[model samples]
Target: MAGNPVVTDWTTDFDHTDKAWAADPYPIMDELRDTCPVAHSDRFGGAWLPTRHEDVSAIANDTEHFTSRSIVVSEHRPPMELAPEGIAPPISSDPPFHAQARRMLLPVFSPQTIDKLEPSTRAYCQELLAALQGKDVVDAAADYAAHIPVRVIANMLGLPEEDGDKFRGFVLHVLEGVALPLEERIVGFQQLFEYLMPQINDRVANPKDDLISFLLASELDGKPLDPFHVVRTVALLLIAGIDTTWSAIGASIWHLAKSPTDLKRLVNEPELMPTAIEELLRAYAPVTMARLVKEDFEFQGCPMKAEDWVLLSFPAANRDPAFFENPDEVILDRSPNRHAAFGLGIHRCAGSHLARMEMRVALEEWVKVYPDFSLEDAGAVRWSGGQVRGPRVLPIQVGP
Candidate 1:
């Protein structure tokens, strides 16, 4: 965040980590979607930005031209051979093997499984809200939104809930620290696996009723999963699960705090909560996934070179006018909406069900407790840089 150069032209020399992009990328994306839908940049060892929904979907579905070898766009690309089971399983894995890896994890994220987590997730949301009581103004993001997923994921991974701070540190370094020096970044990544190794080893010796243990007991290709595979998958769960959902929840609360009409509607018509949640997700979709060009080829008039980074902007796609009605507007009851907030194609977020449940419960609890809230200082609300965007420092007045 500190060392990245300022972006001169979003279309040509784009840097997703730039302050302007993080503050408000919709305008930037809208411009690109119209003028240069497949914008190219030389940064991050060359990268492409496709703001159109169709292009994003095409590239996401086309595994032959792009590989998930390195989902994060940075100076250091993971080796080409890492594919089929990239650093992380499923999300980072490519086809054939991607299907097998993804299929194995499907049972863990099935709706039935997530439904079982809702009660505790809701209770955790209530617990967070309880702490905000009697305060005129509160940091909605730090105090409420950020903690929900941390607790939920910690419980799932069989880790100590109090280690939320550590988890946050890991997420930040992995997601937002893309521009850091390669050596420093490597050390940061090592720390995460180092922390998880003991937990994984403990599960191996004394298996428990958690995801780590489940993976250990599980088989891949008719053989037990390797220890490192278990570690990488667990790392994926920790990193992916916390950051994206936290952003979604925080962004939703940020929206409600500013839009009284929408807030009042959800409060008055409780049944609209489900529909409204999707609307929020579409309007403020947080994640932008990255892929490496498999080989040099032309795409939508652009000559993409092999190993070039392609940032599949799901947030931008969700706002493409070609795909949705009044793409820029947030219509709570927008039924038949097919926004790709979770993502498109094979690598779509696996924990989407759990994410939705977290967002719904978090919003419901917040609104139930503080029905009338507004942005305390719009200027003070800080949005995170890099792929995932959200209100990281949202301050809201508790009541009207």
Candidate 2:
């Protein structure tokens, strides 16, 4: 096993294993971007740092050169070899297969399709907010932001709303481990696989209006999708959709609550909701990293080898001086933002449209009712680890 990377300079500082930096990595990232854009880190298992917008975007967009074969940097590899991420090959083999699967999943999350769900999405957001109406202090991440995305995804996947809490527990447990104890995580994954198998079987037996049902009924290349593929695809969606969006929403709310000026601006002008979402995503860069490697050659003048893990730093990219005029500030109406928060190229997040809608609805409705909310204890905000980045606890006091 390899060891974590080391940073010897003030410009390049990070303890990849440090819990504090995970809570708010921008400061360290800024240091790195200013001094060492391509600095190497031994703390993160020996991956080079690419903090500038151009370097990160170049690596992400040129998938053929820097393949998406190992999206996570954990010490151990996942059991499911063809798990629809982190490997490149023939469509039936890896990269191509992921592309095809994405095409099939796109319709379920298309802007048009997601727009149709706006009423239900907004209603749910209001309902969740209503539950928090009288509370003096609440952990917004747990009590509100995290729950909405999972519930929405559950409904979309034909799961019961009551199971949302349980599913979230499983997701947090699986993702939090830096080096997931293989046996325990494997057992957990197996249980999840077992839990979803019957659901897929039922969907196959009797199709409905949900995603699993659509997967079961649809044909890939003249034949029905393999049942295992459907399960893997749904599993990916559940993990990615629930965790990433939940974190993004939590981070957005945390930032806004911390800034009364920004909150006041948005509350006074509802039209800024959409731009606010982008700015928040850019400022926060919630998703940790996407792992990939070169298929044949080198990157940034470094000698390349097949399957060598590299981290694509989206948060760093979002703050690159070349991309945004003032990378650190929250410009709500940041026009031509063109960020890689949802990633870039073919594998960009399939659920981005829905994610935007969810955030927009949550912000539009939450600010309307809780415009006066303020952080209960600003220093109390904590973040959890995993492929996702977000506040673990965001306590706030809401009132008129």
Candidate 3:
């Protein structure tokens, strides 16, 4: 990553993994939205970044032109035969198949279902805070924000909470390992499957009240789901479910750490939590999805080819001046906030309800305890370097 070439022109050549983009992509995205609107790059085996909300929404909704076969943009492209079901369903599923796959899990992540987990989620947050009692400064990203979703999702999947380190390793390899060598990446996938196959087998043999067992018992077209399908879906639940929410929580904390006024308002105005959560999600939205161009075609005058990667940036779309009022400013109670933080179209995040619950509870409990805190070292805060972006090393000063 260090030796990668510097970007001379954002319109002609842009690299999401580049240090500049990783550190602060807002400016780059804003400039792209103004000038190019649709920026292309040779990196990641040729990819395009559509900065405008209209284009992003169009591409996201047009399954006929784009394929979800491989959502994460990387050097490696999945074989053509993998489609219809893709590597993971329903995120990776396409068209009619995607609908069925997604419908099966709706009840699992429904509002009612996620609400039941709130008590335990709050308990865990309190436990985490309890452990940090004497700390004057803390790494919020690593110490606090990162653990909530991992614990919640781990519990949902019936995996041991102590196996969190392993889950983080798999998440890093899958989401942030875009620039990794193909062979190395394959090994990462192999390692994840190796670790999961055993758990999956155990669930198959002995059913439980968790997602894995639920998937194992599920059927498609009146036939039981395949073992590989179960593994892929579980991996999706564990990887996507954990990283996106973790990043959202960390980014929200990072914003409060820097903006004392916003932090103070949140502490004093307890009723503003719901609106504040949506505003934060709109402004610092994480998880930029990828879609492989279905076939060679021109979109908004840019020549695209089959198998090309489209970096569908919900973050960029959320900030587009054409969409939101004074988009850059984080207004806590911005009304009509129908932003695509959870994405747009049929692929809108199924885990959004769960993510919202986690963030609200996490922030509520955090501000209730440490109502006044600031960044310990602005320079020391480190952000992740791939599609899913957030503060990975956020040091906050909690006491004088």
What clash pairs does model 3 have? none
Off by over 4 Å in 3: none
For model 3, how does the per-residue alpha-carbon lDDT over 1-400 read when each residue is reduced to its tens digit? 5335888899988988888888999999999999999999988889999999999999999999999999998889999999899998999999889998999988999999999999999999999999999999988999998999999999999999999999999999998888888889999999999999999999989999999999989998899989899999999999998879988999999999889999988888989999999999999999899999999999999999999999999999999999999999988878989889999999999999999999999999988889999999999998897789999999999989
Runs in model 1 lying further than 4 Å from the true structure: none
- For candidate 3, the per-residue lDDT at 358 reads 98
> lDDT values of the candidates?
0.92, 0.74, 0.93
Residue range 218-246, candidate 1, lDDT tens digits:
89999999989999999999999998999
Per-residue lDDT tens digits for candidate 2, residues 280-398, read 99888777555545454667666555555566778889988888899989999999898889886666777889998888887788887787778899889888754578887999878
Query: What's the true lDDT of residue 275 in model 3?
Result: 95
Stretches of model 2 off by over 4 angstroms after superposition: 1-17, 42-45, 78-95
Better of 1 and 2 by TM-score: 1
The model with the greatest lDDT is 3
Candidates, ranked, lDDT: 3, 1, 2
Per-residue error (Å), model 3, residue 284: 0.4
